[model samples]
Target: MAVMTETEPPPPPPIRGRTLYRLRVLRHDPTALLGLVLVVVLAYLVVAPLVAVLSDAFRLQYGDEAHAGQAPGEWTGYYLWRVFRSPVSRLLFWEPLLNTLVVAAGTTLFALVLGGGMAWLVTRTDVPGRRWLAGALVVPYMLPSWTFSLAWLSLFKNERAGGQVGFLEAQGVRTPDWLAYGALPIIVTLGLHYYPFVLLLVGNALRRIDAQLEDSARILGAPRRTVVRRIVVPLMLPALSSAVLLVIGRVLGTFGTPYVLGLPADYRVLSTGLFQSIRDRSTGVASVLATVIVIIGVLVVFMDMRLMREHRRFVTVGGKGAMDRLGRLRRLRRPAFALALLVFVVSVLVPVLTLLLSTITRTPLDLSTFTLDYWLAERLPGAVGFPHGVLRGHELWEAAWNSLRVVGLASVVCAVAGLLVGYVVVRGTAPRVAGFLRQVSFLPYLVPGIAFAAASLSLFAVARGPVPALYGTTFLLILVMAVTHLPYSSRSGIAAMTQLGREPEEAAQVAGASWWQRMRRIIFPIQKGALVTGIVLPFVSGLKELSIVVMLATTGTQLLTTLSIGLVDYGYTQLANAVVLMIALLSFTMTTLTQRLTRTSLASGIGG
Candidate 1:
């Protein structure tokens, strides 16, 4: 009775002002506000450009009113009819569609075979120099996809496209159309560039595979091949599926590879067809084709979703005494080692050497002739359009500087925003908002870069809502690049954040720390590696980007990619090769520096 009389009421709930309440809510459950903001912003960025593209499909577009026989801005089915039912439908859509499927399929097959085999050899076998091969194989990925095509053309391109004959053709060996300009070259070039995607994904999975499972199967008298066919193959399906999807998506929209390789043979895929339509001022046709490509890309992604759902029932991540078991190559060891070495030489070494030789030679592939003009001459005696050497003036340096500035700003902002978006998606209280933010962030990856560029140009060329007109501005370039490359940073952020425990933040909260304080002191320090990864991947990729920037760059805003492409357009082959080499060198240098600074790796950072 005395205790009851003396007992005070339960402590009152803490009183908070509106600002403090808001801050507390943000610190505790940011989903309702911060997550919503990210979702809305990301959705707008991804969906607006798409809407801009699709809207052009239904309405009579500018410069197409005459062709559509309708007033501009009027809604009509003319574009749909022309693409699906008109007389040239087969030529305009069907053939290219068929060709697109063929290229995508071929490229996927090539990448899977080469990449999968290399992954096994490097990760699951005691191959000689496994460390070197592993690093060497990934080098090709750092270079632009078009670099392979350019190198291929330098060695295999005949006189079909005019200008100078390729090395072989110059040596009086006539390269057939099939080998030099069409599907074969396109497939090979793309495969060389994209196989690293497979290697990284599959090898990461392979390294994590449990040796106990295979050992048990072997002890049960299961043959080696049978164990692999059953246990290994099933375990690898998820990685294989992802690698296939990535390759297909890239092949579907890759402009430079197909454009460089397919032009001479009239081998047009959907991407090249889209480019042709836009170049020809057929905006209606371009929209129709672009929409179809996006549809295909979506279907591929959906199929992957279904596969992932099915794969979840089978777990491979954890098991007692699980460890990587390298296969005993035994008699096949050296042959396997040789095979891996050959791939490294062909995929990484050959193309780079070819580009170097091209840059030094007035007559490429001719060992007897060499000139330093492309690298350092003040003037060229017989040069036509670009009458000066590549290093003759500030043009090259200016382009490099612009590239560094634009890409640097974009990557830095992208990395920071990615971290915030990741925080919201993972730790926020709003499930719906989190999910939307997560998906929208990855949306740009499936969309073709050129189609994305077209959409951005259409949408941002004029002011809308809070954003002013961004066309013709360097900031626009930075924004386009950032959005286009958001998948890298966001994915990195989300992966890193998922592994981080909330205990640190909760501890900070218990200590009366604010949200920003927690993020700065705990989250940022732990995720420094991932932040560097996000920044570096985008910077490396952005340095070599051609398609997205081609449509967006204005006069006097030449980036390195645009500079190289300009030289190519003017038939400055040697100079173009020099610029390409410079791009590769810059990419390699930055990658190396970043690794030293952060002590991370391409394989680990990329996969994990």
Candidate 2:
């Protein structure tokens, strides 16, 4: 009678029937269980830490209770006031905010123009060394970003930070503050480091555009400029805008280049500001600054999503047989080639040679000061703890081993987890679960490395319920690295999974194969290349990763990146340069091997 009424609820199903229904669903789609598990795990790993950081910003930290006029864990707006409205706001927040915006804007513009030009030159023009140049330009990105900053200092440093003078300064040239450190140098160094983002994104997009669209416009009496403006530029906007956002996001979170170049002149961006707060043990201030960075990064991510949605409207509807042709440079070919060569020289050759030169020379660009003390010597005259050469020292070897062990394990974990996440996203029966898995896995991509590290430290450094405190542990380092870099591998997995059919797994299932069996035999073999890429790429990234590990690394967990940074902080310039060059060499070697094995370049694999 109750069921007969429209407003009344239906009778509850029998317990046996409910059990049978769930069993059938589970049997038919086992990924539903996997998806549910992944959702819960990722929610805790990804969302909980962010919530902790936000909570910490409002809560009075232990020592700040006196100033905050509240209990340690109680809520207070004192941090917000201190960061934004207090007397020290200019140094703590306002100046850094302004500097951040300027450097971000300037770096974005510089990377766009330089990277966009190179993309067009190689992908659309008949340049002499298009193939070679295309591969060479991405090399700058492979090296640690701070490599350029170190090289810049080697070439142009004055006696500002109170160590040794740079090559130009040694040669009787005075490098001014603006040129040597602060916003200008930050912009140039970060731009050089990040331009490859634009090149890869815009280059791929340009390659996909139909040449027929431009030809059609030209035939309709459109001038060359008109054709480019109307047909080419509009189609390229999505990629161009995406590149802009990518560069901006990077500029917002980047610490090494800005810190290395900006610190001497007392210049601070939001990233460096956050680092200082953390270093000074100002937990509330660090949380507030990190929150601001996370908010800006989230805005960028939302803008990217909106732009991606708008991208659907600009699709080119054409037949499968699309014509593609490169424009001939003709009389300007040599000049164009020279210009491209110069970019490679400045971006790659100069920085690397400078770093290498710095490692062996007491004074940069001074051949007379050359020595193997930095690399092979057992002892140095005036050096303190780091007396031995980089190779001969136990510290360098220990750090290198730690880098390999931690990052290597993290990469493997990321690859496997990413593959499973892709499986759930692409093949699961439950739409909501799949969507949740997809979004949560990708959320870390929007977070800057340093902010995420701070968040991870906040949440996981202390034990929660059954989990143990992870602070200062190698496992924590591995976990944070894996989570931060998961986006790259997960994206690769999703793309690869979309192309894979369930038929193989379905057939295997019919043979009474378990889910693990199907995945192990059928899915794993088919997607091995993607798995390897997910591993090697993260490994390469982790090798050069300073921002994330620097936030978390302790003495026992010294990675090559943190070790190099430590040497820099101790004013061991040559030792630092040597470590940096080794990191670059190791990263480059891994990337090269991965490219040959997987047939995927580092630039192409990223954000694709």
Candidate 3:
């Protein structure tokens, strides 16, 4: 036996050719095959559309007539040259680019200062009402981004914008034009909306940090400042980087805030620029803008990845219950906690309350002239015009109905695909396939919503393969929304399935249960909570979404959010406000329901 082992078993039967070798490897690990299928399918669905946009950017098109001195399908640098070097490029590209950078940078700075300060106060000090503040902080993020923009406009729109007087004017305050629109309002609105991201990320890290490190430094005769600067700050860098990256990524791609604010002042950020280019039939220029945005996105994502990798090396695990407690500021604690509470109230509650108030008001800024007519009045005469009362009108009801139908369809598609991808990634044995699937599934998260919509428009405006023309159909909106939101639901599914161990499935299999039977009886039951969350979140997101569907939607297929955009375009601020409020309510209710469902499931899982 020893001699036979030394002979190396005759070279293991001379390993087979490439195809057979792949088959053998797959036979040993079926998970890889599943992952490969997922990756290829997702690439076609997600990556192919992006490629189409890139290809579109280099092609020249003429306006129906004689080709205009340029070949129809010829590759040209006209778009790039015009966008980057032409005289109008400053107005079209550079100014907006600078504005985008300024807004993103300012938003990041404000969010970090506000969120980090609050996180430190709550996690380090014994702040009063920390629990309430923590809960309230995230509410702004849950609301639609445009909700804040519209609320701000309602509270501050001056005479310059041609809208009715705002709340400030009603209160004997002359609001400045700068405050009502442009980069200032956008920065403030976006900052307030996204600060919660920083809070959650930084606060969680703060909570998990071991207290002993700070204490050890203190015991070594280090001062509080020294300990903070040398010990705490170093540890917090990774979290800060992550928060900044996330906030920047979000702000860069944001369309609603910029659209609501920027369009009024001709403040064209990349997203708005792309939207304008597309609307004006400048597809080549729009594609270039989309590419630019995608490049920025990819760069930011790379930075985030690098930071996360670096964070892994700094991990500290130790004994239980090691948390540092900062000495209270005593009398200052109440004031500090109150200020934090005030910020939450102003950012989350006040804006939402203002929206509710504006919805009931007959005129945009006249708070005293309250009326349920906006909510109840059905089909006012055309003379009422722009903000005409159509609350209970057939069109309004139809848009709402369409919104529910599209969002419901999208949610189902996303949930099912996300769960399948998640299951394959978590339980499958193929490392190569799993890694590929995971990366491609997350590609949409790196893409701006407007860019994605533009890509979809470019791809599906004409038929390809089994998929027919989807340009004006409700199905296009559903597909775009579903794919754009896949990352969230897929990530949620992965996390949920990972938490659920394999023992149940293994036991089912041992009892002679088939794969589908095991999935139905054992796996699905355990993961139902996550599945609901996955579905509900996308439903809510799709309900309030503006950027992704703005390009693809037509009059016949308009969702409520898109309808709100149309109302805005027609200068119907009050009616737009009403529509926005309805969308916000729907989103808020869905989010609350999902959170409750998630919590109940988590609790049940823990108890069982």
Candidate 4:
């Protein structure tokens, strides 16, 4: 009997049994399954491309074989040496790096001064038309950043580029190089575009401050400047720092403004330098620059988070009955109003009108040279490639349609995927998987659009494993845009889902409803408004998105933005201005409609 007992032991559990058990568990718990799927997809879509970019920076690229004496795809340190240690590194990296730092610092300072001051006027002081100014000040943000640059050139361009002089130059007023095309114009234009960040963040912060704090300081015989320094500034440091980081981050990666204004003067920042490398097929060099840009962006984001945490340690405690009255301007009210109006004119109305004027007149602001030819004519001299008026041409319509189709589809994709991501993040039983999914989904927000595009071009441009090469395809554009803009929708989704209880989905599950059925019939119906907001935000953003598509779009998939920039490159300024106006018109109309529907303008945060 003892010998028989040793003859047989329990059979080992089959591998198939374990796998089937996991499948069954996954089937029952859709959130866990979804989280797993999302982690994989986001890793491939978001993380893989970044890895590819980083890898490329250390590898020998195709055209660098001769220079590096290594085969393409082999690991090499030549790119690093070329970018940071070579003789031409000054032009290739150092100068651009220095220029980027200067521009970022200058733009941050300018935006903070302008935006923080305006925010104080609107939120703290009794400024005239505060409501209207609050809304109007953010208009430049909605327009593409380069819209200001184009308008700047229309008004201030010198003979630097040689083809077409600006309005001042046309009038025999030769604009200076510094004011026309270098860091000054770039800084000012980008500042005007980004100041809204400060307005929204600082304005909201200003509102949250108890007016009694300032009044208390003033009543204690503290001078106005002393009161501001001791009380108001300390309370608002978090927001000011946030705005500074936001402005700096944007300036770091913005391409259109710098490219349009900088190329003529050989003024290159990291963005334009990366662009030049990409255009010249210097993939290794572009990868190095892009990596540097991305690292800077990540640092900025980390700094923002750390600063917010540090600032919280010195929180201002306000009483329940805190008075929030607007500061009386007395006799300065009218002048303050005029100053805000003048800013609006310079930032919003002037750029828009300048572009409109350019489109109408053969020369800017010249009424006698006015002609409808730019918009309505079928043919005009010197309009070489784009022969017809923008309104009359199929090119404009086609590009508009492409923008709508690609961006529209991408927005819908983002909304759905974002909701799924939220579901997984909020309900998944696996904490690790859920946390990974959440973090991965938000990674694209840290990577700049241009750098992301370059990464996408590097990773997806060629076939990998079973995936086919995706370079120059509309699908690639849609994919890149959806990933780049996912943060807006994902944040919207998470916020909406956080307020919703799991009871509805649970009840549906008890009724034998499947996961997809519950999502479609219960979750989606309940979160329709959030979903719409998600779609509208991304759609509006993508409509004006230039940096992402500029690198990904092909001739067949030209968006309104690319088409406009192309005209600019071709020396067709009026034609380009016409397209820029169309983009602004569409963007403004959509934002206005959204406001009408939701009782919430995009700038409502600042206004409140």
* Per-candidate total of colliding backbone pairs: 0, 0, 0, 0
Instruction: Encode model 1's per-residue lDDT on 56-152: one tens digit a residue.
Output: 8898987767777889999989999999999999988999889888888888999999998998888888877787777778888888888898898
Better of 2 and 3 by TM-score: 2
Question: Which ranges in model 1 have alpha carbons more than 4 Å from their true place?
Answer: 1-33, 215-220, 316-323, 465-467, 495-526, 604-608
Query: What is the Cα-based lDDT of residue 329 in candidate 1?
Result: 90
Q: Rank the candidates by lDDT, best first.
A: 2, 4, 1, 3
How far residue 334's Cα lies from its native spot in candidate 4, in Å, is 0.8
Encode model 2's per-residue lDDT on 92-116: one tens digit a residue: 9999999999999999999999999
For model 2, the stretches where C-alpha displacement exceeds 4 angstroms are: 1-30, 317-323, 602-608
TM-score of each: 0.89, 0.93, 0.89, 0.95
Give the alpha-carbon lDDT of every model: 0.83, 0.89, 0.81, 0.88
Residue-level lDDT tens digits of model 3 in 118-210: 777766677787666677677787788998898898888777766566788767889877888898889888888888877778887777678
User: lDDT of candidate 1 vs native?
Assistant: 0.83
Root-mean-square deviation per candidate? 4.5, 3.8, 4.9, 3.1
Per-residue alpha-carbon lDDT of candidate 4 for residues 1-608, written as tens digits (9 for 90 to 100): 44544567789779999889888766766676677778888899999999999999998987777899999889999999999999999999999999999999999999999998899898878887888999999888889889999999999988888767899999999788988998999999999999989999999888888878877888889999998888888888888889999888888879999999999999999999998999999999999999998998999998988998987665777863463577789999999999999999999999999999988898778999989999999888866788889999589999999999999999999988898888877777788887787788888888878999999999998899998999978899888889988888888888888899989888888898888888889999999988888788889899999988898888999999999989889888888989999999999888887777667875675544
Error at 154, model 4, angstroms: 0.9
Ranked by TM-score from best down, the candidates are 4, 2, 1, 3
